[model samples]
Target: MAGQACLFCEIVKGERSAHVVMDAPDAVAFLDARPLFKGHTLLVPRDHYETLTDLPGEFLGPFFEHAQRLAGAMESVLGAAGSFVAMNNRVSQSVPHLHVHVVPRNRKDGLRGFFWPRQKYESDEEAADYAARLSGGLT
Candidate 1:
């Protein structure tokens, strides 16, 4: 990733605060500080891997297992019609560490192509509420 100062690594290590939605031994899911939607979540591996190819073969299954749960939570918990799940290996990856974006989706959500209009929670309390709901759905 971005050496020892990786942002996602900081979140994984609890050095930075994030509205965490799912915490497991291998991965951590959290609400996007700048969300694409209210319930948008980012799922990252606890370990720092710069890109998808950097991830160990053994880690692939466990990493995506958490993603599956998050995608489901977008619908099961947030009442979204469906979900949009994606990852960028290097080109469009904002953070150096690998992560997948799990965004709630509806038929007329107005998300066209790769251009996403970002959104924000009304407040931290609202963000936390979303985190709590998605977090519970994973269990």
Candidate 2:
């Protein structure tokens, strides 16, 4: 886990701006600035933990439960068939802090197995709209 210097940590601390989706007691979900799809969202712990091994045992269930909630939101709110929920322990982890990528997906969305093609929203407003919908689903 990185310290306060981590980018996600900064966002969690409100030092950085993110199109936040939801703020749970133990985790936070937000739209990915660089999305794999229009509704791609990231779920992370409020506290910093670099990799899976670093996460406390008590944190595991709630973390995945939140991820599942976000994934369901991707379908119900965004019209996705389902979601691609994943995390990289260390090797493919872009951020030092552990996070789950709850990417909305449909069959033949060009995501072959685990090979994802990165995408972007038309604008921040568009991203915010997605955030708002997913945020609402969290309620």
User: lDDT (CA) for every model shown?
Assistant: 0.91, 0.89
Q: Residues 4-98, candidate 2: write the lDDT tens digits.
A: 47999888999999999988889988889989899889898999999889999999998999998998898898889999888999898989899
For model 1, the local distance difference test gives: 0.91
Any runs in candidate 1 off by more than 4 Å, and if so which? 1-4
Regions more than 4 Å wrong, model 2: 1-4
TM-score for each model: 0.96, 0.94
Residues 1-139 of candidate 1 have per-residue lDDT tens digits of 2335888999999999999998899999999999888999999988888888989999999899899989999999999999999999889888988999999999989899988899989999999999999999984
- Positional deviation of 89 in candidate 2, in angstroms? 0.9
Per-candidate RMSD vs. true structure? 1.2, 1.5
Checking candidate 2 for backbone clashes, the offending pairs are 1-50
